[model samples]
Target: MTPTSSLKLTWSSALESGDRATDVQHKYLIEIINELAEAIETGKAGQSIRKILNLLKQYTDWHFCREELCMERRQCPAAAANKEAHKHFMRTFDAFAEEYKVSGGSEDIAMRMYKTLTDWLVMHIQKIDTNLASCPDNGCSR
Candidate 1:
């Protein structure tokens, strides 16, 4: 794999979910992903990669909780599906984390993480998260 410094993953505006807070979170995730890519490329990741992975794990869980709360509050029709998707993503993430621990941030693990954070995350924000924007009050109601 190419050096992490050589790789650049920028956040595209097209990934926005139309909710300011959600959008901010998504952008931060993109930033973290870029950091991970850089770490991998520079061969400096080591335990740093584990920290990033832990950050990702925590952030995703927190974000999913917020999203699910929004979905529930809005009485969104997609709530069930959204919850399922969140569960699935958490499971996938846990498995990846385990693999990373076993592999020690190998190139393959880096590639997998890059894909998950960039491609999968963008798709989820654009497709699934965007649905929340359709709700009244932008799904922020208590």
Candidate 2:
């Protein structure tokens, strides 16, 4: 890819969900995204796209499951919508993964995939995850 501009996203308070575990997971997700961007800018993504994307998909699935269960247990209002959003994301990501597998992941496809993933994650955190901050205990702890 080797774009002139940076594609990394900063992890700040603005990205936090006011829950320790969730915030930690979110931070890790940001780190992965940043790593992908670095690889892309170095023209190294083609070699590691499968590993990176698989890791991302696995982590995202785990994270979404934990978040959804917490929300449901805590009776957070965003539970259903969040679950739906997660499903939609998985479908989109799965399609991308399949396409990448078939095409060997071109730089343009990787760049677009990265951008799409980053944008969806940031928006999902800001709009949906922030609601976790108010889920009764404010921590979703058992």
Candidate 3:
């Protein structure tokens, strides 16, 4: 698939959590991931994918930290579960990164990373992060 075609697979409103800050950050992260996907789909140079991978690693780590902090501040009921989820994601991502390195610039590696990230992000935001918005005032409805 071409880059333009890949761009069509973008972040949708279904992922929104009704939290402005989190939504904005999530959108940005999705955009970055999409850029990486597009680069890989379009057969861009290895440098392109490498750059994006580095950016993704950095942004995801930073975002996870911020989200965890927000969960703590808001006393989110699902905070513990959410943190555990983040840890799992980080581990998975690290493993993928290692595979990408070992693949030696193979597009297959990039493709795998793209699929994993897209699936993981969509599920995490919709099912997990959405729960945080409900505790806006640090009080769990449940």
* Best by the lDDT measure: 2
C-alpha TM-scores of all predictions: 0.84, 0.92, 0.87
User: Best-fitting candidate, measured by TM-score?
Assistant: 2
**Prediction 3 TM-score vs. true:** 0.87
Put down candidate 3 lDDT per residue, 84-126, tens digits, no spaces: 9999999999898888788777887887778888888889888
Candidate 1 segments whose C-alpha is farther than 4 A from its true place? 1-6, 138-142
lDDT of 2: 0.85
Per model, how many backbone clashes are there? 2, 0, 0
lDDT string, candidate 2, 63-92, tens digits: 999989888877889999999999999999
Q: Which lDDT value does model 2 have at 80? A: 97
Better of 2 and 3 by lDDT: 2
| Residue 89 local lDDT, model 2 | 96
What value of lDDT does candidate 1 attain over all alpha carbons? 0.74
Please identify model 2 stretches exceeding 4 Å from their true place: 1-5
